[model samples]
Target: MDEIQLTAAAEGMPNFNRRKALAVTGSGLAATIAAMVAPRNAAAAVVVNEAPVTRVNNLAWALARAMDDWMVDLGVDGVPDIWKAHVYPYSQRKHPVAFESLDRSPSPSARVAELEAAFHAEWAALRAIEPALNAAELRYMEIKGSRPVMGEMTPEEADRLRSTTVADLAKLPPNRASVEHAEAMRAYNKADAAARRKTGYGKLDRAYMKATHRTSDVANALLRHPAMTLEDLASKVRVHRVWEYDGEDFNFIMDDIARVAGKAGAS
Candidate 1:
Protein backbone atom coordinates (compact mmCIF):
# COMPACT_ATOMS: atom_id res chain seq x y z
CA MET A 1 0.00 0.00 0.00
CA ASP A 2 2.78 2.40 0.87
CA GLU A 3 4.62 1.56 -2.32
CA ILE A 4 1.49 2.08 -4.38
CA GLN A 5 0.78 5.40 -2.74
CA LEU A 6 4.33 6.64 -3.25
CA THR A 7 4.38 5.58 -6.86
CA ALA A 8 1.15 7.38 -7.52
CA ALA A 9 2.48 10.56 -5.96
CA ALA A 10 5.56 10.56 -8.15
CA GLU A 11 3.47 10.59 -11.29
CA GLY A 12 3.75 13.82 -13.36
CA MET A 13 6.43 15.21 -11.08
CA PRO A 14 9.62 16.25 -12.86
CA ASN A 15 11.54 13.21 -11.73
CA PHE A 16 10.60 10.46 -9.33
CA ASN A 17 12.47 7.42 -8.16
CA ARG A 18 10.64 4.80 -6.17
CA ARG A 19 13.83 3.29 -4.79
CA LYS A 20 14.91 6.66 -3.49
CA ALA A 21 11.62 7.70 -1.88
CA LEU A 22 12.01 8.29 1.84
CA ALA A 23 9.93 6.57 4.55
CA VAL A 24 8.90 10.05 5.85
CA THR A 25 9.76 9.50 9.52
CA GLY A 26 13.05 8.60 11.16
CA SER A 27 16.53 9.73 12.02
CA GLY A 28 17.70 9.34 8.43
CA LEU A 29 16.49 11.65 5.66
CA ALA A 30 18.27 13.18 2.72
CA ALA A 31 18.34 13.34 -1.09
CA THR A 32 14.78 12.79 -2.33
CA ILE A 33 14.09 16.47 -1.64
CA ALA A 34 17.51 17.33 -2.95
CA ALA A 35 16.17 16.19 -6.30
CA MET A 36 13.00 18.26 -6.13
CA VAL A 37 14.88 21.32 -5.00
CA ALA A 38 17.90 20.73 -7.25
CA PRO A 39 18.95 23.73 -9.28
CA ARG A 40 17.69 23.72 -12.85
CA ASN A 41 21.17 23.37 -14.32
CA ALA A 42 21.89 20.60 -11.81
CA ALA A 43 19.13 18.28 -12.99
CA ALA A 44 20.90 16.88 -16.05
CA ALA A 45 23.26 17.90 -18.81
CA VAL A 46 21.45 20.67 -20.69
CA VAL A 47 20.89 19.74 -24.26
CA VAL A 48 18.84 22.81 -25.08
CA ASN A 49 18.79 26.48 -24.25
CA GLU A 50 16.01 29.02 -24.68
CA ALA A 51 17.31 32.27 -26.06
CA PRO A 52 16.55 35.70 -24.53
CA VAL A 53 16.14 34.59 -20.94
CA THR A 54 14.24 36.81 -18.50
CA ARG A 55 13.28 37.10 -14.81
CA VAL A 56 9.76 35.85 -15.34
CA ASN A 57 11.15 32.70 -16.86
CA ASN A 58 13.23 32.00 -13.75
CA LEU A 59 10.32 32.98 -11.53
CA ALA A 60 7.73 30.91 -13.35
CA TRP A 61 9.25 27.71 -11.97
CA ALA A 62 10.33 29.16 -8.66
CA LEU A 63 6.72 30.10 -8.25
CA ALA A 64 5.83 26.48 -8.73
CA ARG A 65 8.30 25.35 -6.11
CA ALA A 66 6.92 27.90 -3.68
CA MET A 67 3.39 26.72 -4.21
CA ASP A 68 4.32 23.07 -3.85
CA ASP A 69 5.54 23.93 -0.37
CA TRP A 70 2.33 25.73 0.48
CA MET A 71 -0.01 23.01 -0.72
CA VAL A 72 1.69 20.24 1.18
CA ASP A 73 2.31 22.20 4.34
CA LEU A 74 -0.91 24.18 4.63
CA GLY A 75 -3.06 21.55 2.93
CA VAL A 76 -4.72 24.45 1.19
CA ASP A 77 -5.91 24.91 -2.39
CA GLY A 78 -4.44 28.40 -2.71
CA VAL A 79 -1.62 30.42 -1.30
CA PRO A 80 -1.95 33.00 1.47
CA ASP A 81 -4.47 35.76 0.93
CA ILE A 82 -1.86 38.49 0.44
CA TRP A 83 -0.24 36.96 -2.65
CA LYS A 84 -3.39 36.59 -4.70
CA ALA A 85 -3.81 40.33 -4.97
CA HIS A 86 -0.65 40.89 -7.02
CA VAL A 87 -0.96 38.91 -10.24
CA TYR A 88 -0.96 40.47 -13.73
CA PRO A 89 -1.24 38.79 -17.08
CA TYR A 90 1.83 37.03 -18.47
CA SER A 91 1.84 39.58 -21.28
CA GLN A 92 2.21 42.44 -18.82
CA ARG A 93 5.25 40.63 -17.37
CA LYS A 94 5.61 42.64 -14.19
CA HIS A 95 6.02 41.00 -10.77
CA PRO A 96 5.76 43.21 -7.70
CA VAL A 97 5.15 40.24 -5.44
CA ALA A 98 8.37 38.56 -6.49
CA PHE A 99 10.34 41.73 -5.98
CA GLU A 100 9.05 42.31 -2.49
CA SER A 101 9.43 38.66 -1.54
CA LEU A 102 13.02 38.26 -2.69
CA ASP A 103 13.87 41.55 -1.06
CA ARG A 104 11.42 41.94 1.85
CA SER A 105 7.82 42.75 2.73
CA PRO A 106 4.71 42.10 0.64
CA SER A 107 2.85 45.26 1.45
CA PRO A 108 3.64 47.15 4.63
CA SER A 109 0.36 46.19 6.22
CA ALA A 110 0.05 42.66 4.88
CA ARG A 111 3.66 41.63 5.27
CA VAL A 112 3.87 43.00 8.78
CA ALA A 113 0.67 41.31 9.81
CA GLU A 114 1.66 38.00 8.24
CA LEU A 115 5.17 37.95 9.62
CA GLU A 116 3.98 39.01 13.05
CA ALA A 117 1.35 36.30 13.20
CA ALA A 118 3.73 33.68 11.94
CA PHE A 119 6.53 34.66 14.26
CA HIS A 120 4.19 35.02 17.19
CA ALA A 121 2.91 31.51 16.60
CA GLU A 122 6.43 30.23 16.31
CA TRP A 123 7.73 31.88 19.47
CA ALA A 124 4.66 30.72 21.28
CA ALA A 125 5.52 27.15 20.38
CA LEU A 126 9.15 27.58 21.35
CA ARG A 127 8.39 29.40 24.59
CA ALA A 128 6.12 26.56 25.54
CA ILE A 129 9.14 24.30 25.35
CA GLU A 130 11.35 26.58 27.45
CA PRO A 131 12.78 26.66 30.95
CA ALA A 132 15.40 24.81 28.89
CA LEU A 133 18.98 25.45 29.78
CA ASN A 134 22.45 24.56 28.66
CA ALA A 135 25.22 25.42 31.06
CA ALA A 136 27.82 24.92 28.35
CA GLU A 137 26.23 27.56 26.11
CA LEU A 138 26.00 29.96 29.00
CA ARG A 139 29.60 29.27 29.84
CA TYR A 140 30.58 29.82 26.22
CA MET A 141 28.82 33.17 26.13
CA GLU A 142 30.45 34.15 29.38
CA ILE A 143 33.98 33.18 28.41
CA LYS A 144 33.60 34.69 24.99
CA GLY A 145 32.28 37.87 26.50
CA SER A 146 35.27 38.34 28.80
CA ARG A 147 37.67 41.21 28.31
CA PRO A 148 41.24 41.10 29.47
CA VAL A 149 44.53 42.66 28.56
CA MET A 150 46.15 40.34 26.07
CA GLY A 151 49.39 40.38 24.05
CA GLU A 152 47.70 39.75 20.67
CA MET A 153 46.15 43.13 20.03
CA THR A 154 47.32 45.63 17.43
CA PRO A 155 46.61 49.24 18.44
CA GLU A 156 43.48 49.24 16.25
CA GLU A 157 42.24 45.93 17.63
CA ALA A 158 42.81 46.99 21.19
CA ASP A 159 41.15 50.35 20.69
CA ARG A 160 38.06 48.76 19.16
CA LEU A 161 37.84 46.07 21.80
CA ARG A 162 37.81 48.71 24.51
CA SER A 163 35.08 50.65 22.74
CA THR A 164 32.61 47.89 21.87
CA THR A 165 31.31 44.54 23.04
CA VAL A 166 33.00 41.36 21.79
CA ALA A 167 29.70 40.21 20.33
CA ASP A 168 29.47 43.40 18.29
CA LEU A 169 33.08 43.07 17.17
CA ALA A 170 32.47 39.58 15.85
CA LYS A 171 30.22 40.97 13.15
CA LEU A 172 33.02 43.10 11.73
CA PRO A 173 35.79 41.74 9.55
CA PRO A 174 39.06 43.01 8.06
CA ASN A 175 38.65 45.80 10.56
CA ARG A 176 39.83 47.03 13.97
CA ALA A 177 37.02 45.40 15.94
CA SER A 178 37.20 41.98 14.31
CA VAL A 179 40.54 41.14 15.92
CA GLU A 180 39.41 40.62 19.46
CA HIS A 181 36.17 39.14 18.23
CA ALA A 182 38.00 36.28 16.55
CA GLU A 183 40.17 35.81 19.62
CA ALA A 184 37.10 35.73 21.79
CA MET A 185 35.54 33.02 19.63
CA ARG A 186 38.64 30.88 20.00
CA ALA A 187 38.51 31.19 23.77
CA TYR A 188 34.80 30.49 23.75
CA ASN A 189 35.16 27.39 21.58
CA LYS A 190 37.82 25.95 23.82
CA ALA A 191 35.84 26.71 26.93
CA ASP A 192 32.58 25.50 25.44
CA ALA A 193 34.08 22.22 24.27
CA ALA A 194 35.80 21.65 27.59
CA ALA A 195 32.62 22.47 29.45
CA ARG A 196 30.32 20.27 27.41
CA ARG A 197 32.78 17.51 26.43
CA LYS A 198 30.57 17.15 23.35
CA THR A 199 30.36 19.32 20.24
CA GLY A 200 27.02 18.34 18.71
CA TYR A 201 23.43 17.60 19.67
CA GLY A 202 23.64 19.11 23.16
CA LYS A 203 19.86 18.58 23.40
CA LEU A 204 18.69 22.15 23.95
CA ASP A 205 20.52 23.58 20.93
CA ARG A 206 19.32 20.73 18.73
CA ALA A 207 15.66 21.30 19.52
CA TYR A 208 16.20 25.03 19.28
CA MET A 209 17.86 24.61 15.91
CA LYS A 210 14.99 22.44 14.77
CA ALA A 211 12.56 25.11 15.81
CA THR A 212 14.64 28.11 14.86
CA HIS A 213 17.39 27.34 12.37
CA ARG A 214 15.52 24.89 10.17
CA THR A 215 14.81 25.32 6.43
CA SER A 216 11.53 24.46 4.69
CA ASP A 217 12.33 22.47 1.56
CA VAL A 218 9.77 19.68 1.64
CA ALA A 219 6.77 20.68 -0.52
CA ASN A 220 5.78 18.34 -3.32
CA ALA A 221 7.58 19.28 -6.55
CA LEU A 222 4.50 19.67 -8.72
CA LEU A 223 4.32 23.43 -8.04
CA ARG A 224 1.08 25.40 -8.06
CA HIS A 225 -0.56 22.02 -8.47
CA PRO A 226 -3.34 20.88 -6.22
CA ALA A 227 -3.83 17.40 -4.80
CA MET A 228 -6.45 15.44 -6.73
CA THR A 229 -7.90 13.58 -3.78
CA LEU A 230 -7.37 12.70 -0.14
CA GLU A 231 -5.28 9.70 -1.14
CA ASP A 232 -3.34 11.90 -3.53
CA LEU A 233 -2.65 14.39 -0.79
CA ALA A 234 -1.47 11.60 1.48
CA SER A 235 0.82 10.23 -1.20
CA LYS A 236 2.16 13.67 -1.98
CA VAL A 237 2.89 14.17 1.69
CA ARG A 238 4.60 10.81 2.04
CA VAL A 239 6.91 10.70 -0.96
CA HIS A 240 7.43 14.41 -0.44
CA ARG A 241 7.61 14.23 3.35
CA VAL A 242 10.78 12.29 4.09
CA TRP A 243 12.39 13.85 1.08
CA GLU A 244 13.07 17.36 2.50
CA TYR A 245 13.26 19.72 5.43
CA ASP A 246 10.45 19.15 7.91
CA GLY A 247 11.55 21.82 10.34
CA GLU A 248 12.97 24.41 7.96
CA ASP A 249 12.96 27.91 9.47
CA PHE A 250 10.80 30.68 8.09
CA ASN A 251 13.69 32.86 6.93
CA PHE A 252 14.95 30.35 4.36
CA ILE A 253 11.43 29.85 3.05
CA MET A 254 10.07 33.36 3.45
CA ASP A 255 10.96 34.49 -0.03
CA ASP A 256 9.47 31.50 -1.79
CA ILE A 257 6.46 31.30 0.47
CA ALA A 258 5.76 34.97 -0.05
CA ARG A 259 6.08 34.65 -3.78
CA VAL A 260 3.66 31.73 -3.98
CA ALA A 261 1.30 33.15 -1.42
CA GLY A 262 1.09 36.39 -3.35
CA LYS A 263 0.80 34.52 -6.62
CA ALA A 264 -2.05 32.43 -5.28
CA GLY A 265 -3.88 35.57 -4.30
CA ALA A 266 -3.38 37.18 -7.70
CA SER A 267 -6.13 35.16 -9.27
Candidate 2:
Protein backbone atom coordinates (compact mmCIF):
# COMPACT_ATOMS: atom_id res chain seq x y z
CA MET A 1 0.00 0.00 0.00
CA ASP A 2 1.04 3.59 -0.47
CA GLU A 3 2.32 5.43 2.59
CA ILE A 4 -0.86 7.51 2.87
CA GLN A 5 -3.05 4.43 2.61
CA LEU A 6 -0.94 2.56 5.11
CA THR A 7 -1.15 5.48 7.54
CA ALA A 8 -4.92 5.72 7.11
CA ALA A 9 -5.39 2.00 7.69
CA ALA A 10 -3.22 2.19 10.80
CA GLU A 11 -5.43 5.02 12.15
CA GLY A 12 -8.40 2.60 12.50
CA MET A 13 -9.95 3.46 9.14
CA PRO A 14 -10.82 0.59 6.80
CA ASN A 15 -8.80 -0.09 3.68
CA PHE A 16 -8.78 -2.58 0.82
CA ASN A 17 -6.53 -4.93 2.77
CA ARG A 18 -8.85 -4.85 5.79
CA ARG A 19 -11.82 -5.77 3.62
CA LYS A 20 -10.02 -8.95 2.52
CA ALA A 21 -8.32 -9.62 5.89
CA LEU A 22 -9.19 -12.51 8.21
CA ALA A 23 -9.45 -12.32 11.99
CA VAL A 24 -5.93 -12.94 13.41
CA THR A 25 -5.21 -14.76 16.70
CA GLY A 26 -3.41 -13.07 19.58
CA SER A 27 -0.72 -15.78 19.37
CA GLY A 28 0.12 -14.70 15.79
CA LEU A 29 0.00 -10.97 16.63
CA ALA A 30 3.80 -10.78 17.07
CA ALA A 31 4.42 -12.33 13.67
CA THR A 32 1.90 -9.97 12.11
CA ILE A 33 3.77 -6.99 13.58
CA ALA A 34 7.11 -8.34 12.37
CA ALA A 35 5.77 -8.75 8.86
CA MET A 36 4.66 -5.13 8.78
CA VAL A 37 7.67 -3.59 10.57
CA ALA A 38 9.93 -3.30 7.58
CA PRO A 39 9.11 -0.42 5.28
CA ARG A 40 9.11 -0.90 1.53
CA ASN A 41 12.20 0.44 -0.23
CA ALA A 42 13.36 0.31 -3.80
CA ALA A 43 16.31 -1.87 -4.74
CA ALA A 44 19.84 -0.50 -4.52
CA ALA A 45 20.37 1.80 -7.46
CA VAL A 46 22.79 4.66 -8.03
CA VAL A 47 21.13 8.07 -8.12
CA VAL A 48 22.50 9.74 -11.24
CA ASN A 49 21.43 13.29 -10.42
CA GLU A 50 23.04 13.27 -6.98
CA ALA A 51 21.22 16.30 -5.72
CA PRO A 52 22.59 18.01 -2.62
CA VAL A 53 21.03 16.50 0.52
CA THR A 54 21.30 17.63 4.13
CA ARG A 55 21.80 15.63 7.31
CA VAL A 56 18.19 16.45 8.23
CA ASN A 57 17.02 14.22 5.39
CA ASN A 58 18.87 11.33 6.98
CA LEU A 59 17.40 12.08 10.40
CA ALA A 60 13.92 12.30 8.92
CA TRP A 61 14.36 8.97 7.21
CA ALA A 62 15.60 7.48 10.46
CA LEU A 63 12.54 8.80 12.31
CA ALA A 64 10.27 7.34 9.65
CA ARG A 65 11.89 3.96 10.10
CA ALA A 66 11.60 4.26 13.88
CA MET A 67 7.88 5.04 13.58
CA ASP A 68 7.45 1.98 11.41
CA ASP A 69 9.19 -0.11 14.07
CA TRP A 70 7.02 1.44 16.78
CA MET A 71 3.87 0.67 14.84
CA VAL A 72 4.94 -2.94 14.48
CA ASP A 73 5.66 -3.22 18.20
CA LEU A 74 2.19 -1.90 19.11
CA GLY A 75 0.46 -4.67 17.18
CA VAL A 76 -0.29 -3.33 13.70
CA ASP A 77 -3.06 -5.85 13.14
CA GLY A 78 -4.49 -6.13 16.67
CA VAL A 79 -4.20 -2.45 17.69
CA PRO A 80 -2.67 -1.63 21.05
CA ASP A 81 -4.74 -0.15 23.90
CA ILE A 82 -2.96 3.16 23.51
CA TRP A 83 -4.31 3.66 19.99
CA LYS A 84 -7.55 1.86 20.69
CA ALA A 85 -8.57 4.57 23.18
CA HIS A 86 -8.75 7.06 20.34
CA VAL A 87 -10.28 4.56 17.89
CA TYR A 88 -13.22 2.85 19.63
CA PRO A 89 -16.66 4.19 20.98
CA TYR A 90 -16.99 6.10 17.72
CA SER A 91 -17.20 3.18 15.30
CA GLN A 92 -18.04 -0.52 14.93
CA ARG A 93 -14.40 -1.25 15.87
CA LYS A 94 -13.29 -1.64 19.48
CA HIS A 95 -11.57 1.17 21.38
CA PRO A 96 -9.82 1.39 24.72
CA VAL A 97 -12.23 2.80 27.35
CA ALA A 98 -9.50 5.07 28.64
CA PHE A 99 -9.20 6.79 25.26
CA GLU A 100 -12.94 7.10 24.76
CA SER A 101 -13.42 8.58 28.23
CA LEU A 102 -10.44 10.93 28.01
CA ASP A 103 -12.63 14.02 27.69
CA ARG A 104 -15.14 12.91 30.36
CA SER A 105 -16.41 15.81 32.49
CA PRO A 106 -16.05 13.96 35.79
CA SER A 107 -12.66 13.34 37.45
CA PRO A 108 -10.74 10.98 35.07
CA SER A 109 -8.60 9.46 37.81
CA ALA A 110 -10.63 6.23 37.65
CA ARG A 111 -10.32 5.95 33.85
CA VAL A 112 -6.60 6.68 34.08
CA ALA A 113 -6.23 3.77 36.51
CA GLU A 114 -7.91 1.36 34.13
CA LEU A 115 -5.77 2.57 31.22
CA GLU A 116 -2.59 2.08 33.21
CA ALA A 117 -3.62 -1.44 34.22
CA ALA A 118 -4.44 -2.51 30.67
CA PHE A 119 -1.23 -0.95 29.38
CA HIS A 120 0.84 -2.86 31.92
CA ALA A 121 -0.90 -6.12 31.16
CA GLU A 122 -0.20 -5.78 27.42
CA TRP A 123 3.38 -4.66 28.06
CA ALA A 124 4.02 -7.64 30.30
CA ALA A 125 2.71 -10.05 27.71
CA LEU A 126 4.98 -8.49 25.08
CA ARG A 127 8.02 -8.69 27.36
CA ALA A 128 7.31 -12.36 28.11
CA ILE A 129 7.78 -13.26 24.46
CA GLU A 130 10.31 -10.53 23.65
CA PRO A 131 13.15 -12.86 22.67
CA ALA A 132 11.07 -14.63 20.05
CA LEU A 133 9.81 -11.22 18.95
CA ASN A 134 13.39 -10.01 18.51
CA ALA A 135 14.31 -13.09 16.50
CA ALA A 136 11.35 -12.48 14.24
CA GLU A 137 12.49 -8.89 13.82
CA LEU A 138 16.00 -9.98 12.82
CA ARG A 139 14.58 -12.50 10.37
CA TYR A 140 12.41 -9.83 8.83
CA MET A 141 15.38 -7.50 8.40
CA GLU A 142 17.49 -10.22 6.80
CA ILE A 143 14.70 -11.08 4.39
CA LYS A 144 14.09 -7.41 3.55
CA GLY A 145 17.76 -6.74 2.87
CA SER A 146 18.43 -9.99 1.04
CA ARG A 147 21.05 -10.94 3.61
CA PRO A 148 22.21 -14.36 4.77
CA VAL A 149 19.59 -15.80 7.15
CA MET A 150 22.29 -17.79 8.98
CA GLY A 151 25.96 -16.90 9.50
CA GLU A 152 28.85 -18.59 11.29
CA MET A 153 32.62 -18.77 11.62
CA THR A 154 33.86 -22.01 10.09
CA PRO A 155 35.20 -24.65 12.55
CA GLU A 156 37.49 -26.07 9.87
CA GLU A 157 39.38 -22.78 9.52
CA ALA A 158 39.69 -22.51 13.31
CA ASP A 159 41.02 -26.08 13.60
CA ARG A 160 43.52 -25.68 10.75
CA LEU A 161 44.82 -22.44 12.19
CA ARG A 162 45.13 -24.03 15.62
CA SER A 163 47.06 -27.01 14.24
CA THR A 164 49.48 -24.93 12.19
CA THR A 165 50.14 -22.50 15.05
CA VAL A 166 50.66 -25.36 17.53
CA ALA A 167 53.21 -27.00 15.20
CA ASP A 168 55.18 -23.75 15.01
CA LEU A 169 55.16 -23.36 18.82
CA ALA A 170 56.36 -26.94 19.47
CA LYS A 171 59.86 -25.88 18.37
CA LEU A 172 60.10 -23.25 21.16
CA PRO A 173 62.18 -24.00 24.25
CA PRO A 174 60.31 -24.18 27.55
CA ASN A 175 60.83 -21.53 30.29
CA ARG A 176 59.28 -21.13 33.78
CA ALA A 177 55.95 -21.76 32.03
CA SER A 178 55.23 -25.49 31.56
CA VAL A 179 56.17 -27.01 28.18
CA GLU A 180 52.49 -27.45 27.34
CA HIS A 181 51.66 -23.87 28.34
CA ALA A 182 54.70 -22.49 26.49
CA GLU A 183 53.82 -24.45 23.38
CA ALA A 184 50.25 -23.18 23.54
CA MET A 185 51.46 -19.62 24.00
CA ARG A 186 53.81 -19.94 21.04
CA ALA A 187 51.02 -21.45 18.94
CA TYR A 188 48.75 -18.54 19.78
CA ASN A 189 51.48 -16.04 18.91
CA LYS A 190 52.06 -17.83 15.61
CA ALA A 191 48.36 -17.77 14.88
CA ASP A 192 48.17 -14.06 15.62
CA ALA A 193 51.15 -13.35 13.41
CA ALA A 194 49.75 -15.47 10.58
CA ALA A 195 46.43 -13.66 10.84
CA ARG A 196 48.29 -10.38 10.37
CA ARG A 197 49.94 -11.71 7.24
CA LYS A 198 48.67 -11.40 3.64
CA THR A 199 46.72 -14.68 3.56
CA GLY A 200 44.61 -13.94 6.61
CA TYR A 201 43.97 -10.38 5.50
CA GLY A 202 43.00 -11.66 2.06
CA LYS A 203 40.55 -14.17 3.53
CA LEU A 204 38.78 -11.58 5.70
CA ASP A 205 38.81 -8.93 3.00
CA ARG A 206 37.37 -11.34 0.42
CA ALA A 207 34.51 -12.45 2.64
CA TYR A 208 33.44 -8.83 3.26
CA MET A 209 33.39 -8.17 -0.46
CA LYS A 210 31.29 -11.21 -1.24
CA ALA A 211 28.79 -10.38 1.51
CA THR A 212 28.44 -6.80 0.21
CA HIS A 213 27.52 -8.05 -3.29
CA ARG A 214 24.61 -9.89 -1.65
CA THR A 215 23.78 -6.81 0.51
CA SER A 216 24.35 -8.93 3.62
CA ASP A 217 25.57 -5.83 5.43
CA VAL A 218 22.52 -3.78 4.48
CA ALA A 219 20.42 -4.94 7.43
CA ASN A 220 23.28 -4.25 9.86
CA ALA A 221 24.41 -0.94 8.42
CA LEU A 222 20.91 0.43 7.89
CA LEU A 223 19.85 -0.59 11.36
CA ARG A 224 22.62 1.56 12.80
CA HIS A 225 22.32 4.51 10.41
CA PRO A 226 19.35 4.41 8.11
CA ALA A 227 20.67 7.37 6.15
CA MET A 228 23.86 5.69 4.92
CA THR A 229 24.55 6.41 1.29
CA LEU A 230 25.51 3.69 -1.14
CA GLU A 231 28.99 5.17 -1.38
CA ASP A 232 29.20 5.73 2.35
CA LEU A 233 28.47 2.02 2.95
CA ALA A 234 30.91 0.86 0.27
CA SER A 235 33.72 1.20 2.80
CA LYS A 236 33.36 -1.40 5.55
CA VAL A 237 34.76 -4.78 6.48
CA ARG A 238 32.71 -7.97 6.90
CA VAL A 239 33.73 -11.57 7.61
CA HIS A 240 30.53 -13.53 7.27
CA ARG A 241 30.52 -15.01 3.81
CA VAL A 242 31.49 -18.39 2.29
CA TRP A 243 33.94 -16.79 -0.17
CA GLU A 244 36.58 -14.13 0.57
CA TYR A 245 36.29 -10.52 -0.60
CA ASP A 246 38.33 -9.62 -3.68
CA GLY A 247 36.37 -7.02 -5.61
CA GLU A 248 36.29 -3.20 -5.47
CA ASP A 249 32.77 -3.28 -4.01
CA PHE A 250 33.91 -5.65 -1.26
CA ASN A 251 36.86 -3.41 -0.42
CA PHE A 252 34.58 -0.38 -0.08
CA ILE A 253 32.10 -2.12 2.19
CA MET A 254 34.94 -3.38 4.40
CA ASP A 255 36.33 0.10 4.71
CA ASP A 256 32.92 1.55 5.59
CA ILE A 257 32.27 -1.02 8.31
CA ALA A 258 35.76 -0.51 9.69
CA ARG A 259 35.37 3.26 9.76
CA VAL A 260 31.98 3.04 11.48
CA ALA A 261 33.28 0.47 13.96
CA GLY A 262 36.20 2.76 14.76
CA LYS A 263 33.91 5.75 15.25
CA ALA A 264 31.64 3.67 17.48
CA GLY A 265 34.63 2.58 19.55
CA ALA A 266 35.89 6.13 19.99
CA SER A 267 32.46 7.38 20.94
C-alpha lDDT values of all predictions: 0.38, 0.35
Off by over 4 Å in 2: 1-34, 40-104, 108-267
| Residue-level lDDT tens digits of model 2 in 155-202 | 764554456666576664433224455566666656544543423443
TM-score for candidate 2: 0.17
- Stretches > 4 Å off in candidate 1: 1-41, 44-48, 52-55, 61-82, 85-267
By lDDT, the best candidate is: 1
| Residue-level lDDT for 108 in candidate 1 | 28
Model 2 lowest lDDT segment of ten: 1-10
- What is candidate 1's local distance difference test score? 0.38
Model 1 TM-score, 2 decimals:
0.22
Quote the positional error of residue 227 for candidate 2 in Å: 50
In angstroms, the error of model 1 at 1 is 40
lDDT of 2 at 80: 24
What TM-score do all the candidates reach, one by one?
A: 0.22, 0.17
